[model samples]
Target: MGWIGETVDSIKSLQIRQVLTQTVSLGMIVTSALIIWKALMCITGSESPVVVVLSGSMEPGFKRGDILFLHMSTDPIRAGEIVVFNVDGREIPIVHRVIKVHERQDTGEVDVLTKGDNNYGDDRLLYAQGQLWLQRHHIMGRAVGFLPYVGWVTIIMTEKPIIKYILIGALGLLVVTSKE
Candidate 1:
């Protein structure tokens, strides 16, 4: 009986140690990810260095599952450049090509008009009611490059809430079950 009790105690102690190690490791991983994200933010000069295409609005040039890399700088935006911008009352950012750029004569502020390659018309219909153009304030970043079909996972997770939960759960389980 004494030996059995000692064995059980040892098992409990080992389990506690395992759990603590996993928790600490997960915390470290999360911290490392945050640090890397901050580094990317600083290096790219963009709030979001990377973005997943949420819609097929920019199709033919960019697909819905494409992963786009963005670079933001002080350089003047040029025509034919792909960019991401937010419209008033819209939560999601849009990816489009700059078709026209009009600089304010008084303030020198640049206003841009965008269009989708696959769409029939410009994005004015998608903009907020009565808003004619997108300002610099609404611009997120200019698209530098893209990886095809890399953002499908993100799109899938967004499309189905359960998939996100399941993926997170699996990652957690992997972290916990992994032997250090």
Candidate 2:
């Protein structure tokens, strides 16, 4: 009991000023990241301003590990626009190009069909089971630009469990041990 208290007291009393300085520095770094993410959301007009391609569904045009920039506009979604969408029960989002659009006059709503560039058929299988078409609500954003092979780091980390852990551990260690 005496040794534990003495040890803790030594640590807590020593380097108190330096510890607070590093702690505040780390907080600023984390806050800066959040601010940058929010700024991207505002500037791109998309909830997810950037996305990493996880599958090769959109090959030739976009391969796995490619990074895409998205922008949402009030204009109606048009055929040929590559968009990211979410379906009920799916954990990950899907990126595909719009193939068809059915506009309803009564409600002014749009029903869309999407297809992958490398796929043999439209994205019927990717949609919610038994659901025929994707409504505007499923769409997250439209692809405005892309950077090829940039997201391989994310893909590799996802594919290899240990790499993900190591990367995360390294980041945590860096944050914890960094002086500034």
The global C-alpha lDDT for each of the candidates, from Candidate 1 onward, is 0.90, 0.90
Q: Kindly list the per-residue Cα lDDT of model 1 for residues 94-152, writing each as its tens digit.
A: 99999999987898899899999888999999999999988999999999988999999
Give the distance in Å from residue 168's predicted Cα in candidate 1 to where it truly belongs: 1.7
Task: Report the C-alpha lDDT of model 2 over 1-180, residue by residue, as the tens digit.
Answer: 999999788667657777777778778988999999999999988999999998888888898889999998888999999999999999899999999999999998999999999899998887878999999889999999989999999888778989999887898768766665
**RMSD, candidate 1, Å:** 3.8
Clash-forming residue pairs, model 2? none
Off by over 4 Å in 1: 1-16
Q: Which ranges in model 2 have alpha carbons more than 4 Å from their true place?
A: 1-14, 175-180
Model 1: lowest-lDDT 10 consecutive positions: 8-17
Q: Each candidate's root-mean-square deviation in Å?
A: 3.8, 3.5
- TM-scores for every candidate against the unseen true structure: 0.87, 0.84
